[model samples]
Target chain A: MSDGARERILAKVRAALADVPRGEEPEDVVVTRGYVRAHTGGELIGLLVDRLTDYRAVVHRVPAAEVAEAVAQALKRRGVRRIVVPPDLPTRWTAASSVVAVADEALAVAELDGVDGVVTGCALAVAETGTIVLDAGVAQGRRAISLVPDYHLCVVRADQVVGDVPDAVALLDPGRPLTWISGPSATSDIELDRVEGVHGPRTLEVVIAE
Target chain B: MSGTFVGMPAFPEAASAATQNAQLRHNLRKATHTIRGKRAAVVSELDDWAELRAAGKAIKDRTLRHLDVYLEQLEEAVTAAGGHVHWAADAAEANAIVTRLVRATGETEVVKVKSMATQEIELNEALAEAGITAYETDLAELIVQLGEDRPSHILVPAIHRNRAEIREIFNRTMAEWGVPAPANLSDEPRALAEAARVHLRDKFLNAKVAVSGANFAVAETGTLVVLESEGNGRMCLTLPETLISVVGIEKLVPTWQDLEVFMQLLPRSSTGERMNPYTSTWTGSTPGDGPGDFHLVLLDNGRTDVLADEVGRQSLRCIRCSACLNICPVYERAGGHAYGSVYPGPIGAILTPQLRGTSSELDASLPYASSLCGACYEVCPVAIDIPEVLVHLRGKVVEGKGTTVERVAMGAAGWVLGDEKRLGLAQRAAGKARGLVPKRHLPGPGAAWTDTRDIPDIPEESFRDWWAGRGRGQQR
Candidate 1:
C-alpha cells in the first residue's frame, strides 16, 4: 500500500519538475568565501561558545572519556533530579549519572511536562551559527522530549559540526522529522524587552563531547 | 476566486475601525506575543535552523517555478491512485465544482477541516447557497462559525476573541447549528474545549462527505499532507466515505524529500513545536482504512498571476507559517480585520492585492498599511522580501492612477530642476515666501502627510546666493 502511494506521489512530482527550467539545482548556488579562515575543531568550538553565549545558551565542554561524569555534574549543578533519556541514547553517556532516569516515551502533554530535564545527542551542529539539528529518530527520541523538559542537555560530537547553513542543509534528510535549536526559547515584548522560555525548555545546555 | 472582496472600502477605513478597538487590540497583542515567544524558543534549539529555513525556501521556489508540471503530475498521480481531479480557475469555478461533487455524493452535509483555501473562496457560503451545509469541525473554526465571524489569525482562527466572548457565542449560537451548548457553560479554556468537542463529535462520525485543504501536497506520490494541533483533521480525512480537498496549486512540492524540509519548518514556524500532534496524509483513498472515494480540486484562482512577476513571485514561497504575522508591528497595531481578507498581515498585504488585483480602494491601500520596518521580512520562513514588494506595489498603484495633479506636480518640479536659473530663482523665492508658509502643512492632500509630522522651515538664504556672496575664491 505504501509503495503504491509513494509511486503515485512520485509521478506527480516528475510532472511538476518537467516544466521547471532545468537550471542548476539550488545546491549549486555559489557560496562566496569569507575573510575569516576555516578553523580547527578547537577554534570552531570556541566560535560556537561565543555565538551560543551571545544567544543566551549555556555552553560546556568535557573530554569524551568523562562524558558520563560531565552529564551527571551538569544535571546536579542545575538541581535536576529527574532526567529524560532518549530511547536510543548511548548507555555509556549516562552510566555515571545518579539522577532518576525516565525512558523517552510518547506520553500525553501533561505527563511529558512533568519531566525535569532531557539529555540527547544532536544530528549535527553549525559552528558558525551555534545551532543544533535533531532528527527525532534515535538519539533524539520523540520531538517532545527536548521540548517539554525545563532543561535540555544536547551532546554534540565535534565531527558532526558543520561550518555554514548551506553545508548543513546538504546533510539533512527532508523526509524524516528534524528539529533545529539555536538557544533556549525566547521572545520580546511590545517594549522590546526580551523574555526566555515561554513554551519549550527555559534553559538550554550544550555538552560538547570531545 | 469569484468570492473575492469586490466592494470593500479602502484599507484606511477598515484599519481605522480596527485601531479604535482597544479591547480587541489588547487581546490580539497578548495572544500573538505569547505564541511568538514560544516559537522563538523552540526555533533556537536547532543550530541548523537557518539551513533548514533556507532549504525550505529553496524547495518551495523550485516547486513554484515548475508548478504547472508538478500540478499535472499531481493530477495524474491522484487519478492513478483512484481519485478524480478538477481544475478551478477562480472561486466561482471552485464552488461550482465542489457543489456538484457533493450533489454527486448525494450528501447534503459535509464535515470540513480548518482550510484557509476554502475560506478564501467562501466555500461554505457558496455551499449554503447550493442547499448544502458544510460544518467546520476544527475547534477554533467551530467557534468562529458558531459566532458567524471571520478568522483573524492563520493558526488560531479565533485569536481575536477571549474565552468569555467564546462562551457567549457558543451558548447563543451552537443550538442553531446542530448541538446546543451546555446549560451552564463557563469561560474556562477546558470547559470551552469540551463543549466544542461534544458539539463536533456527532458531526464527525455521521458526515459521509469531508472537505479539506492540504498543507503540502507531495507530487512524488500524489500524497496530501495536513498538519494540525487538533486531531479533528485526522477524523475528517479518515472517517468520511468521500474526501474532497480544495488545494491551492502552489501547495505542491516536487517530492517526498521536499516534503521533509517543510515538515521541519512548518510545525516549528507555525505552532512553535518540534512536531505537530496530528499530521494526516492521504493519497486518493483506500478500500477500508479511509475514505473510499477522493476528489482533488486544484485551484488556480490568481496564483498564475502571482507567478508571472519576477520580484513578487517569492510570495508564493510562503508555507503559511504565520511567523510574518506574529512579528509584524503594523499587524500588531491595526489587527487582521483591517486587511479585509482571509489572509491577514504581511503575507496578506502582498498576496491579497496580487490575487484580487488593486482595482478597489481597499486593495490599493493595503500596500501602505505597514511602517516598512522590515520585521515581517526578517522572520518570514520562506524569506519573502515583504517591504520590497510593498514599495513595488505602491509604484504600481501610483502609476495606475495617472492622477493629473500628481503628474503636473512632478512635471513642474522637473522643469524647475532642469533649468539652473529657474531652480535658483525658485529657491530664493521660497526663502522670501517662508513667512507666508504655514508651519505645519499646505492643507488638503498635504495635510495627510503632515498630520503626524512637522514640515521643516525654509532658511533665510539659498545656498547659491550664499555662495555668490562669499565670492569664487572664498567659496572654500
Candidate 2:
C-alpha cells in the first residue's frame, strides 16, 4: 500500500525530467573527473602527521618495531588507567601497554563509557585531510568504544596512510560502519570560535607507526 | 514545509526590520567574514579546485537526471541490507511516517542529528503533535531550540547567536529540559560547550530511538553518511536501538567512489575543515554495531517540482555547505531570518520559490531577494548558478501575477526600440523635455524606482543623433 507513495514520487521525478533525453546511462553525462587525485607524494605520512597535529591531535611517529611501546607511551602520557580494545586487535600493538585492556566483546554501552580511553587500529589515514578511517575491521572496535570514552589513542601504520581523500575512500568498505575522524570532536558553533572536546573524545592521540 | 513561516510578510517587508537591526547586521558580518576567510584559505590549497567543482556539478547533474533509476536501485540495496525503506510524497506524509516509526518503538523522545530535511518538514512540531519530543543534539541546534529561535544559517544553524547569547539561553532554559546549567556558567565558548555536553549526555545514553538526516546516501551500498563536528551526531547515529533517517531523494550519489569527490568538496567548503571531527557511514542495520533496526524515509515534498526546472535544477545540487551564504553580500546585510525559510541566502532565493512556489507573499518575494551579484556562483562547490536561477524565478513571478503595469511598460519600450525611426523620434522628444524632468522622484509607478535612486540627466542631443551627425561633419 505504501508503494503508492513511492510510485507517485518516482512518477513525478520522471515527468519532471521528461525533457532530458531518455535511456541515457548516468555515465553518459560525461563528468570531467579531472581533479588532481593526490596533493602529496611519498611524504604523505609526514603530511598526515603535520595535518593531524594542526587539529591538536597528539601525533607520535615511531618505528614499526616500537608500535607497542608507542601505544604504551601515548596511553601513559594521557594517564589512561583502563582502555578498551577490539577483540581482533593484534596482540603485539598493546602488548607492552600496562593499561588494563578491556575487550569490547559483549560489553554494554555503559561499561564502555566507564573506560578512560580506547585503543584501535585504523583502516587507513588521509594525508591531505589528516583523517583516520575506522571501519570496524579487526582492531577498530564498534563505533561506541571509540566514541564513548573521553580519550582515544589510535595507531596508523605508514603503509595504511594515503596521500588524499580519494585514495583513503578507495580503501574503505562502505558495507561496514565507517568513522572518518580528523581530530578530537570539536565545535565552532559559538561565535565561530573552535572549542574542542564536545561529545567525542576530548583528546585524540594518533601514533603513526613507520 | 511547515506553516511556521506562513502569513509572514514578503521579502522587502521582512528584510526592512532586519536591515534596521544593527546588532544582527554586526553579528552576521563578523561570523560570515570569519568563515569566509577560513574557506578561502583552504579552498586555495587545492590546485585543481576548478576541476573538482566541475566534477561535483557533473556528478550531481548525472544522479539527478537519472534519479529514478538510482532510487529504485537504492531501495533494493537497502532492503537487501535488512533495512526498510519508506517513501513520502510531501512533508505531512514524511512526518507521519517518522511519527509512526517512533511510536512503534514506544519511545516518547528521540534524539536528532541536526537535519535540515527534518527542519524543512517541521518534523519536531509534527512529532510534538504526535506526543513525541525530539531533542536537537547539535550545539547550534540546541541553542536554536532552547532559545525558541529559528535557524539563520545552513551549516551553523545558530550562527546568528554569539557566545553571550548562547550562554544566556543555556542558563535560562537548560533547567526546563532535564539538565540545569552550572550556577557559575561563564560566557566562554568552551564553558558553553561543556554545559551542552553535560546537558545532552543523559539524553544520548538513554534514548532508544534516534532520528537523523544524511549528508549523502550511496545508492550502491545503501549507505547513509553523516558528517558532524560534535559527537552528538555519532551518539544519535550509534547509541540508539532503532535508527530512522529522513533524507531528501536528491541526496543520493551512484557509488562509493562518488563519495570521494564530495568528501573533499563539502568539508573544505563548509566549516573550512579538511574533514569534520567525525563522519559516520552505515549501510542499513549492522548486526552488532550502531543501530540494529534501521529505516530510511525518502522525501520528495516539492523536490520533483524543483527537479523539473531546467535552469533552476542546479539548486538541487547544493550540498548545504553554506559557502554561498557566507560570501553573499545580500545575505550578509539582510540576514537569514529575512529569508523566512529553513533555507536562506542565495540557495534559499532560488530553492525556496521553486519548492514552495510563488503562492504565498514570502515565497513570491523570495526571487527578488538577491542582487544577482554572482559571488554565490563563484564559490559554489557544485557551481550552481544561483543568479541564473534567481533571474529565472523572477520571470516566473512576473508571469504568474498582476504584472500588467510592468508588462505594458516593457511592451511600450520594446515598440520604440524595435524601429530605429520610432526610437530616434522618441529620443529627440525626450531631449527637448530634458530640462522639465525632475531630478528626484517621478510620478506614479516610476516613483518606487526613483525614490532612493537618481533619474539620469538626459543628454542635450541623443547619442544616436550625435553619432549620425558626426559622420556628416567628418565628410566635410
Candidate 3:
C-alpha cells in the first residue's frame, strides 16, 4: 500500500506543478523574508513580565540567589502543598518551598495529575512572546511533567530569555520534544471570548531569577 | 469518509435558511466580530506584518510546488528517527491505515487532538465502523462531538453554541461518553471548561493509543508540531504508547527554519495570541520520552487535485488559522454549516470546490458564497487571494455546467466588455432606457438573481457616460 500510493501521489504532484519552467529550482521563486526577528526592544525582563502578566500568569522577579525563596513564596501563596520536581532541577530551588517535593522518576499519568503542581527550570524564555520552551532537557524533564499537573511553576534565569520566536528557534534542537507555554491553558472556544484556566495548568506562577 | 456531507444543499439555499435562524446569526456575528478585532490588534503589533505574511506565503508555495521532494525528505528523516511513514492517497486509505495501527496496539479507544485533517476524513466515524472509538479531546471538539453537531468554526468549533447551550449539552450527554459532568455545572465559560477538563482527563490518562493531526511537519528534521490552547494536545502527544498523526501532504515546510516564520504568523493570526498555550514539537520517537511507537500518515485526499489548479492552488497555503473565517461577512451571516465541508468561509469557498470538484451543487455554489469582499485576503497570514480563487472556482463551476443560463449571461457580458465600443453602446442604451428597467426584478431567466432582493437602481448614469462627460482623455 505504501509503495504504490507513495509513487502515485508523487507522480500526481509532479504532474500538478507542470506550469513551472524546466530547470527552475524551488528557491528561484525567491522568498523575501524582510520581517523583523524581534518586535519589542525595552528591558527584556520587563517586557517578559508585561507579556506574562497579559496572559494572566503570576510573575515575580527576584535576585539570582533567592530563586528558592521566590519558589517557596509562590507555592505558599497559592497554598500548593505538593509539587512534582523533575530530576536535575536544582534541589535548592524547591528544597525550601516547604511543599512536598515528589520526584518525577517516570511518574504515572494519574499520579502526576494528582500532584499540586510541577516546577521546572525552563530551557528558554521568549521576551517578545512571553513563551517558556521546555525541551525535556535535564532540568525540564519530559513533556508530561509540565502538562499533567494542574499548576505549573517555572523558574526562568535572565540568561535563558531570548528576544523572539526566531531567536528561540535558532537555539533549539528540534529533535528533542519541545513544549512552548505562553500562558496558563486558556480557550476562546465559547463565543470567541478568552477564558483562562482550561485543561493545562490552571495556575502558572513564574519565578524570574535575575 | 465522504458519507457525512453526502447530500448538503447548495450554498445559497443553506445560507438563506441559516440567516433565518436569528440565534445562529447572533452567535456567529458576536464570535466573528470579537476575533476580527483581536486579530487586527495583534497583527498590527508588528511593523513588518506584510513582510512576514509574504514570507509565510512564499514558504508554503515553494514547499507545495516541490511537494514530492519535500515529502520524500520528510519520510527519510522520520524513518531515520525511528518513526514509520505511511502514504494515504485518499480518506478511505488514511482511515484504513489508522484503524489498522490502532488495532495492532489492541486499543479499543483512542484520544484525539483536534485536527481538521481528521474531521475532513471523518476518521472517528471510520474508526467507529471498525469497532474502535476516537475521543475528541479539544474542548470545542468535545462539545461538538457530544452535541452530535458539525463543527461551526475552525478555532472554536462550538462557537455557534453559547455557554448556556454548552452547559445543556454537557449535562445531557457527558455521562454516556465517559465521565459525567460535575453534578451541577454552570453556564459560565470557566465552569464549562472545567467540566470538559474533568470529563476528558480520564480518557487522556488511560488511553493506550492516540490519534493526532499536525500543525506543521518539518521535512528538514521530521518534526511534527501541534499548536493548541489546551493541554489536550500535549496529553495526547505525550501520554499515549502508540501515537499516530495524520497530516495533509500540503502541510509540509521544507526546513526547521521555516517554522520560525509560521510559528510567529500562525499564533497571531489564530487566537490572536503571541503564542498558543501549548505547542508540542517532536521528531519521531525518543527512547524514554513521548510516544514509543510513532506513525506519520501523509494524506492527499483531493489535495493533489487542488494543487493542479494554478489559480485555485493558493488555497493550499492556508495554515488552518481561520483568520479568514473570522473576518468574513458571508461567514458571519450564514455560519460555517453553509459551506458544506470541514473547511468554511472564504478559504472554504475556494478550497472545498477544488478539492471536491464542482460536480455537486453544494460544491458549485460554494465558489459563489462570498461577496468577493477581499476581507479574507487582508487578514490572511499567508496572503491567499481568496477572492481571486473564488472567482476562478466560479469559472470552473460555470464551465462544468454546460450551457446554463447564468453562463450564457456571463458570456454575453464578457463579449460586450471585450470591445470598448460595444460596451459603451450598451451602457448608453441602458442609461437612455433606465426608467424601463425595473428596480424590483428582471423578467425571465434574470429573475433568479432578484429572487431575494431588488436590483440596484440602474446606477443613476453610466460611469462610462460620466467619464466621457468629464473629458475622458484630459486631466480634469
Candidate 4:
C-alpha cells in the first residue's frame, strides 16, 4: 500500500487525492479541537480514588511516610507470602513486609504467573478515568510482571495523578511500551454483560501516597 | 468485502430470512439495547462530546487527505525502530507475508487478539491452510470460533448467541480445540468466561507466534496501539516470541497526541465504559518485554479505491467501535450475518459497497437497505454522514443500470410533456380511461408498489377540457 505495491500504492493514494490542493500540510487541515482536556473539578487524588473504586479496584490512601506500612498491610490483607518487584524498587517498601520479595531479572512467563502478586510504581495515573500507566520505569519492570500475575498492587504518588487522558498522554514517552490499566481484566462478550476477571489480573489493588 | 465472500445473497433476501428467526431477533434486540443504553450514559457524561467528535473526524480526514505522506513517515519510523515493516496491496499478499513470517520461526500455532483487519483478510483460514492453528483469545472471538460460526458484530462477535448456546458450544468443542470444558460448567457469563480463560491460557503461555491488528499507529514514533477489555491482548502481545500485526492504511494518526481523543471516544462508544480495562502501546520490539522480532504489515486491500471517491471516502473514518451497529434499527432486526461481511450494520452498508464496489447483488442492495432515518449519523463518534452516503451510493448504483420500471415510467412522462399537442392528447386519453384506472393499485407492474401505498385517483375531467368549455370566464 509493499514490494512492487509500495510505489504503486503510494501512486494510487496520490492519484486518489486529486480533490485536495497539492502541498497542503496536515496542520493546515483545520481540526476543530475545542474539547477541554479535563472534565472533572475539585481535588485530583480524591477523584482518582473515587474513579478507581468505581471500577472495582481496591484503593487506599495514606501519608507519604506510611507508604511502606501500607504496602505491607496490602500484602498481609491478601494473605500473600511471596511478592515480585523490580530491582530499582525501594528497599524500605518490601523491608516492612515479611514476605519473600523476588526481583524481576527477566522473569520467565511461568515464573511471573506463579507468584502471588506484583507491586510496582506507576509512571502516572488519570483521575477522570481510573487508570494506571506503566512505562517500564526504574521501579516498574517489564510489561509481563504486571500482566501475567493474577494480582497487581500498583503504587501511585499524589503528584503523578493527572486530571484527564490528554494530561496523562502529554506526560508519557511514545518510545517506551506503555500499558494503561483501569481495573482488573473484564469482558462483555456474553450477551453484552460485563463480567470482571479474565486472563489478566483478576484483582487490582492501588495505593495512593500523598 | 474480501474476495472470499463475493457471492452472498442480496440484502433483502438475507434480511428477510434473518428477521424471521424469532430467537435471533430477541437476542439482537436485547443485546443491542443493553449496549445502546450503556453507550448513551457514558457519552453524555462529558459536555464536550460534540467537540471531541468533530476533532476525531477532522483528524481522520486530515490523515486520509495526505495518507501517502503518513504512510511513508510511518514506514520510516517503524523501520528506524526494531520492527520489520511489510506493505501489502491486497489480502493475498498480507496472508503470504504472515504465513512466511510464522514459518520462519518453525511454529505451528499462534495466539490472536480480536482484530477486524485479520478477519477481513481471513488470516486464520490462511494460517490453517499453512498447517498453522490460530486460536482466537478474545472471549467473543472465542465464542465465535468454538461454535464454528461467523462473527455477526464487530466488538462482540457472539452477540447473536445467548449464554445457553455459548455453554453448548464450549461443552461440545472445547476438547477438540485443546482443553475440555468442566463437566459442571453452567450457563453463566462468569463461568463461561472462566472456561475460555482456562482454555486460552494454555495457548497464550505456550504460543511462540502471535498475530494482531492495531487500533491506531503513531506515525511520529512508530508506536502501535491496541485497546482491549480482556488481558488476552496483553498475553498475545507480550508473551509471544514472534509478533506480526496487520493494520489497514486508514488506522494511522499523525502523532501520539491523537490518541487522547480516541482513548476517550472509543471506550465510551464501544463498550459504553468510562475506560476499557487495558490499552497496550508498543514501538517495534522492546528489549526484554515483548516479542523479539516484530513485523508490521501495512495493508491496503482495496482501501485506495475507497479513497478515490469524494463522497465515499468518509467511511474510512470508522474505528470499528460497533456503536453504529448497536444503535441501528436495521441491524437490530436483520442481524450482522445478513450483511455477509466481517463489517456489519450501517458502517458496513456504506463501507462494504465502496471497498468491494456495487457490482455484486449483495453490495448493490446495501445502499437501498437503509430507511434513511439519520440515526446512525447522530450517534457516530467520527460523524460519518451515513444517510447521506447511503443516498449518494444509491445514486451510484442506479447510474448505468437502465432496465427499471421507474426509469421507463419517467421516460414516458418526459415524452408526453415535451410538446403541447402530446400533453393535450395524453390528458384527453387519460380522462376517457379514468373509470378503468383502479383507485389504489396500478395493474400489472405496480402491484408490489401499492402494498404499502395508494395510487392517487385520476381527475374525472381534464383541466384542458374544463378550460375550453368554460368560455370567457375561464379564459379571463
Best by DockQ: 2
lDDT of 2 by residue, A61-84 (tens): 999999999888878888889988
Error of 2 at A161 (Å): 0.8
Interface RMSD of 1: 10.1
Docking class of 3: high
C-alpha local distance difference test of each model: 0.75, 0.91, 0.89, 0.91
Clashing pairs in 2: none
lDDT of 3 by residue, A27-85 (tens): 88778889888886769999999999999999999999999888898898889988898
The TM-score obtained by model 4 is 0.95
**Residue-by-residue lDDT tens digits, candidate 1, A15-131:** 434544577553453322221222233577777777677667888878888888888888889988888888789988888888888885555445555778999998888775567
Give a tens-digit lDDT track for model 3, residues B172-195: 999998789998788999999999
List the candidate 1 regions with Cα displacement exceeding 4 Å.
A1-210, B1-6, B419-422, B462-476
Residue lDDT tens for model 4, A106-130: 9888888789999999999999899
**What local lDDT does model 3 show for residue B141?**
92
lDDT preference between candidates 3 and 4, better one: 4
Between candidates 1 and 3, the TM-score winner: 3
Residue-wise C-alpha lDDT for candidate 1, range B1-476, written one tens digit per residue: 12344466777787788889998888888877877886898788665667766776777776776665677788888888788888777788889889999999899999998899999999999999899998987766777787777777777777788778889988998888878899899976656666776687668656789999989887877878887644467567766789899999889888765654665678678877555544555666655446788998877777777777767778888889898888888888788778888899999999999889988888989899888999898778778899999998888888857668778888999999999999999999999999998998778666777887898879999888888978766664
Mind giving the per-residue lDDT tens digits that candidate 4 earns over B261-371?
999999999999989999999998988888999999999999999999999899999999999999999999999999988889999999989988888899999998788
Alpha carbon lDDT of residue B161, candidate 1?
Answer: 82
Better of 2 and 3 by lDDT: 2
